[model samples]
Target chain A: MKFLDFFRSKRPSSASIAKERLQIIVSHERRRPSTPDFLPSLQKDILEVVRKYIQINENQIKLSVDRNGDCEVLELNISLSDPGKK
Target chain B: MKFLDFFRSKRPSSASIAKERLQIIVSHERRRPSTPDFLPSLQKDILEVVRKYIQINENQIKLSVDRNGDCEVLELNISLSDPGKK
Candidate 1:
C-alpha cells in the first residue's frame, strides 16, 4: 500500500506544469480551430436577417473577447450602413 | 525486451488524446490568462507617446486575430480623435 501510494502521489514537476500552462495560453491567444471562413457565413446570416429593416456597414462589425483573470468580456461593434446607398 | 517495448509503445487512448486536444483548443479559444489590466497600461503608453502630435480616439481602436486552418491574421484598427475636439 505504501509503495502504491508513493507512485500515485508523486507531483508533476513545476517546469512541466509551467509548460502546460504556457501551451494553454498560446493556444487560447492564437484562437484555435475556428476558421476565418466563419466570418462570411456570419456576415451572410446577419445581412439576410437585417437588410430589410436597415442597411448595415458590414465592414464595421467586430466580435471579440478579452479575458482578465477569471473575468471575460465579449465585445461587439456594428455600424449602420450609409443611408445614401439605400 | 519485447514485453518492455510493447508496454512502452502502447499509444495513448483516443479519448485521452481528444481531451488533451480539446483542452488545448479551449484554452486557446478562450484567450488564456492575459489580464485586461494590460490594456490600461497600453493606453497610457499610447497617450504618452502620441499626445504631442495628435489626440487618439482610444474608443475606436481594435486588436484582434482571425484564424483559418493553418493561416492566422492579426488586425489593428485605430481611429484618430476628432480634429474639432483638439
Candidate 2:
C-alpha cells in the first residue's frame, strides 16, 4: 500500500487536514444534546469555590464539560465587573 | 481530468466532510483571535433588552458571534432558573 501511494501526489490525507480544523472549532463547544441533571448542583459547588477569588453571583459563571476526542475539557467562564467603571 | 475520476471509487471529497463537521461544532462557539471591542458593550445592551422578558443578570447569558464560511451566526444561550427547585 505504501508503494502504491507514491504513484499519486504526496499530499497529506484530507482526513487529517479536516481533523485539525475540527479540533480548532470544537475546542470551546460541548458535544452531545443531553445535559446532565447534576449541572445545577455542580454550578452551586463551583460558585462556592470561586467566591474566594472574587465577589460574583450565580449569573456570572458558566460551566460546560466539553469532549474532545478521548478527553473532556471543563470550561469555565467568569465575568468580573471593572472596579473603575462602577 | 473528468474521465480519470471514473476509475476511482466515488468518495465525497474530504473537504466536504470536514466542512460538515466544522458546521456542527462551530454552531455555538465564536471564531477569530481578537475579541471585538464591541462585545462588552454588546453584552450590556443585550442584558437591557432581555430584562423585559425574564429576570436574568449578565452572567446568565452568553453571546457569541460565530463565522461559518462566508456567513456569521449569532449564538446566545440564556439560562433560566427552574422556579420549582427553589
Candidate 3:
C-alpha cells in the first residue's frame, strides 16, 4: 500500500490551498472600478517600451497593482509573439 | 526503498508552484491605487451588515475583484472574532 501510494499523486498541502485562495481573492481585488486614471498612460508607455524590443499586441500586455498590509506591489505581464518569425 | 520513500515528505508538485506564483502576482496586482471610490462606502455597508450578526473590526472585512478573460469575479472575505464570546 505504501509503495502504491508512492506512485500516486501527492495531495495538495495547506500552503498550496492558502496560495490558491489568496490568488483568487487578489485577482478579484484588482478589478475594482476605482482604478487610477494614470493606468492607461502607464500601460501605453510600457507597451511602447516593449514594442521597441519585440512585436506584441496591446492585449498581450497586462499591468495591475496589489496591496498586502501597508505594502503595495506592481505587476506586469507581457506576452510576445512568435520569436522565430521576428 | 519505495516504502521509505513514501514515508518521506512529499515533494511539491508543479501545480503548487504555479499556485504560489499566482498568489504573489495576484496579491501584487490588487494593490492598484485606482481602487473604486465607492469601495470605502461599500466596505462600511458590509461591516454594518455583518455587525448585526457578529463582532468584527473594519480591517477584518475584505473585498476584491478578479477577471479571467471576459468573466469578472467578485470576492469577499470576513474574519470573525471569538465565536463563543458575547
Fnat scores for every prediction:
0.05, 0.05, 0.09
Candidate with top TM-score is 3
Instruction: Give the Å shift of residue B46 in candidate 1.
Output: 36
Residue A54 alpha-carbon offset, candidate 3, angstroms: 0.9
Q: Name the docking class for model 2.
A: incorrect
Decide which is better by TM-score, 1 or 2.
Answer: 2
As for candidate 1, its clashing pairs are A27-B28, A28-B28
Candidate 3 lDDT at A8 equals 23
Per-residue alpha-carbon lDDT of candidate 1 for residues A25-47, written as tens digits (9 for 90 to 100): 10111122331212223324433
Interface RMSD of 2: 17.6
Off by over 4 Å in 1: A1-52, A84-86, B1-86
Say what the RMSD of model 3 is.
19.2
DockQ of predicted candidate 1: 0.04
The CA lDDT at B68 in model 2 is 38
Best by lDDT: 3
Point out where model 2 deviates above 4 Å.
A1-86, B1-44, B82-86
> A1-86, model 2: which lDDT tens digit per residue?
22123212322365532211111111111122332233334334434543433355545554565443422333344444321122
Estimate the overall C-alpha local distance difference test score of candidate 2. Answer: 0.32
DockQ of each candidate, alpha-carbon based = 0.04, 0.05, 0.06
Clashing pairs in 2: A59-B59
What does the i-RMS of model 3 come to? 19.9
